[model samples]
Target: MEWIFLLLVGLAAGTLGSLVGLGGGIIVVPALIYLGSFIPGLDNLSPQVAVGTSLIVVIFTGLSSTLAYMKHKTVDYKSGLIFFIGSGPGSIIGAFINKSMNVQSFSLYFGLFMILVSIILMVRGKIKPLKLRSKYNYMRNYTNENGLETSYGFNPFVALPISFVVGLISGLFGVGGGSLMVPAMILLFMFPPHIAVATSMFMIFLSAVTSSVAHISLGNVHWLLTLVLVPGAWFGGAFGAKINTRLKGHTVITLLRVILIIIGLRLIYQGLT
Candidate 1:
């Protein structure tokens, strides 16, 4: 019965996670913790265990999301490849650090990180199109029959380094990495917001798989939970891809920022109390 319950939770988490580009961890971690608190037998595992387990399930979530994005050519392969170059090593280092930390410490730092991200998002909201109109103005111009028109390029050079940091955060928190990566691609890399989300999903797919493998070798994965979660993740990802086609770039960014703020506040409350 308890296993059945966990499977249901996984399904719901995956659906919401993919829809919002949150990755399953944001939803799955809280769901597991809630269930653990209420269920007697399963409560024996520590909070860290719950977090680790949720992280493992997110591997499926990322892959499923990535596949959906790939069908539309939303993923920018060059950017993903460069970001992977830096992030792959960084993930291992972050995981090692996670293994050594205490649960309370982890919670504290995680909350702090969430808050920091929230602040950045808020600030990003206020920054007008200044940069976009400046040296990176190439996004606003292009060549056509009339001589020139605005063209948006998924330039890799601008997207890579920031994406690496986003990946590092993924390793640290066991997230899909899309939360950070998508925003960076939009704000820093100058990709269209929908494209950024799709590309981030792809990057998350690779990074999550790499991190999950590392977690497995270190004895941090929960296979039972993962099996329960993947199906939902797949379907949710496909749905999200469908939704992305209709949303305008700025609207997606705005929605994502709002969700991030809400999640950040929740994490802060959890950590403080």
Candidate 2:
């Protein structure tokens, strides 16, 4: 029963995470902690272990989503790589910080972060993309299936620092960091929504690798649980990406915003209690 529950959670997390480029860790980490409170086998689960295990699952989710998105030709590989240059070191720092957090504190901070993510989602659409003129900016163009061409660009100096902060949040919380990165890409860098999501997933895969290594070195992962979650996450990620190609994602984002708010409030209450 517990295995089944976990499998379903993994599937849901991966699907939603992949669909939005948020990386499934946002769902997985919270679910693990919630399950730990009452489930017999998971009663001893710690925040660090939950985070570590979630990061492992995120690796598979990111990989699966990135592969699926590749078929759509939406991922910006060069930008993803450049973002990783900053995110990689930031992830290492976040992982080290995670090692020192207690459950209540971790819950409190993570809940706050979730609220922030929800707020970002709420306001993301209202903020128009900015056009900046910089010699250091790298510009690219994309054409949709409808043959409509759009262009976007960003300065590396600005993008690298933003990605670093995204990576730090991801490492600290075992999330994919897409909630932050996707918004930054869209609002600050003028990336199309689809491109931002696809690129974010690509970066998530890279950052997850580095963060997972740090957690592994700290002995924070639950090997059995991680193994159980991987298969579901992998399949769900593929499924979500397929859906993404067909959907505009507004409805899903709306639902996700509400869900995050509820979860954030619940976690915050738990932490306070």
Q: Encode model 2's per-residue lDDT on 1-273: one tens digit a residue.
A: 888989988898889999989998999999999889777777989899999999999999999999999999999999999999999999989999999999888988999989998999889879799888899999999998899999999999999999999899878999999999999999989999989999999999999999999999999899998988998999999988998999878898899889899999988887888
Please give the lDDT score for candidate 1: 0.63
Root mean square deviation (Cα) for candidate 1 = 4.7
Regions more than 4 Å wrong, model 2: none
How much is the lDDT of residue 47 in candidate 2? 93
Q: Write the per-residue lDDT of candidate 1 for residues 16-109, one digit (tens) a residue.
A: 5565566767666655655766767666555456556776777676677777777766666766666777667766666666777665566666
In the order shown, the candidates' Cα RMSDs to the true structure are: 4.7, 1.1
Error of 2 at 104 (Å): 0.7
C-alpha lDDT of all candidate models, in order:
0.63, 0.92
Spell out the clash pairs found in candidate 2: none
- Judge candidate 1 at residue 51 and give its lDDT: 59
